[model samples]
Target: MEHPAALAGPPIGWRDLDRVLVVRPDNLGDVLMAGPALRALRHAAPGARLDLLAAPAGAAAALLLPEIDAVLTCSVSWQEAGSRDVPVAADLDLVDRIGHGGYQAVVILTSFSQSPWPAGYLCRLAGVPVRVGMSKEFGGAGLTHWVPSPPDELHQVDRSLHLLERVAVPPFGGRLHARVPPGAVRAARVLLGDRGPYALILPGASCPARRYPAGRFARVAGRLASSGLRVVVAGTAKEAPVVAEAAGDVPGAVILAGELDVPALAATVAGARVVVCNNSGGAHLAAALGTPVVVLFAGTEQVGQYLPRFVPASVLTVPTGCAPCRQFTCPYALECLDLPPERVAAEAVRLAARGPVRTSAWSSVREPG
Candidate 1:
């Protein structure tokens, strides 16, 4: 692969690059929402080896994206000051690893609420030539392509795509994606074995601020079971208690919390007739797999920015005056998510009746707030 000019231009199109590292060091939902932007990067730099630098929370989603050629993960302790814990050896090691990767360009994707300079500083330390990011904060010499921070109204997908325009990667607004590995496919097949046509209920709490009552989730599961669809509940090992509560006493309901890895979970979601989840990662995964989704949305975050994308989706949310408060702790006890089980179940059943859409292609679906 040819090396980039030592002092390259800011618009040194990703297509001309030999290697590029895309950075999204955040949650699963964040990475999943960045799918369209990653797809844009792949198109812009078809010949360039597109690698990813992800946090432990996002690496699973990064690995599931077929656009990425490789993935590197690190749990950099992001401090309250919007910077990494530089004293940690793991962060330094990441800098060293990135330094050796020979990446000509590094495109950093951050949420509207995050600081990109922390990731940019690491790229700068690694001596990467063309660093790109969007930041409201001044990036100084750390970033070669500094996009002005986008409007908060932009969805996560659009925000990342907006940043990519700085480096000349376009063709925005596409569907979410997840590529299930053969191993994960096998694992999921074994786990679900012959459980025909199930409704997947992911009752795990991705964020305390956005969680729906587990009891209501169990009711939704029971509702689906009554409609002749078997139920499968998924959650992380850490979410076992929540999963157990949501799977409680439901006839033929399968508890899969802690039993499947991210990719296997993706596979399971891919096979589901429909998915019932909170405003969380599973909803994004379902969006990626083109599985219809029902989101028990809380108004803490902008519903437009984070709701499931592309596939058929039902957003069940109560109106709140303090909608999009952006607070992780609800002082009002999450009143925005005060949807009844029957209503949530009705929406889930409605989407389930439509069944899942099977396509890996990106989409141009859009919704107005």
Candidate 2:
């Protein structure tokens, strides 16, 4: 690899650079959305060793992506204030590890409003010559190539891939793909032995507004079971009680909570007839696996921005006057997800019958104020 000064002009056009590190220290859904950008970088520089730096929870998704040659867990704590708590010791250790790896370039992926300071500082501290990221703040001082942020309405995947235009062009509306390891598939089979096809319901989200009521999910599950569809409640340990309560007394309704990792979850979702979930990480994972997804959006987050990107998927939104507010908290109660269980069950039944749904008519109904 040539030194930064030895290269002509900027290192953006150089194809000979062999090692690159991509940093996306965000949540599971954001990390999954970064797959296309990673693939684009790998496609552009096939010989380049690709390393991913992400939060601990995002490590599983990063490990599953075939484009990444290595995965590094970041110790920085992220908060809704958009501030990063970079541990000094961990930062220094990561810097030393990256410095020793001899990376030629680094790409930092971030939203328009969030500062890429931590990533930029890390790249600089690690002595990586060519750093690429959007020029939102700091005036591109630390970046070798500063790409423009996409318009607000752009999908997260598109926004991430837009920065990669400096290296390569990706397909328009690129699909999100996650590989389910064979072991995970086997585990899913073992977990669901002789159960046959079942509908997986993920009723929890990190945000309160994004979560549909557990009682509503239970009602829907019971109705689905009565209609001859087996219901399986799936979620993390924090969501165990919620899923268990939702799956109550429905004879064949099983609660598979806290049993699988991301890849295993993907496999489990892949084997399912369909997935009904809140606007959460599991929804994105199910979409990536090409499984039919019924995502319930709370009208707080932008549906166009965070909704599942699968071909045949349904997005159920309330479309109230306060739709797309993207609020983390709701003061007057979350009416967005206050739909009747019968209606939700009907939609899920339709989805289960018709393979995968393309659009959502459920969003048309009005909710009482």
Supply the global lDDT for candidate 1: 0.81
- The superposed Cα distance between candidate 2 and the true structure at residue 33, in angstroms, equals 1.1
Model 2 stretches with alpha carbons more than 4 Å out: 1-14, 77-87, 138-140, 167-169, 321-326, 356-369
Candidate 1 residue 285 C-alpha distance from true site, Å: 0.8
lDDT of each residue in 49-87, candidate 2, tens digit only: 888888777778975688988888775543234465556
Model 2 root mean square deviation, Cα atoms: 7.7
Give the C-alpha miss distance for residue 219 in model 1, angstroms. Answer: 1.2
- Tens-digit lDDT track of model 1 for 121-157: 8889999988888877665777877777868878888
Error of 2 at 238 (Å): 1.9
Could you tell me which 10 consecutive residues in candidate 1 have the lowest summed lDDT?
360-369
Q: How well does model 2 score by local distance difference test? A: 0.74
TM-score of each: 0.89, 0.87
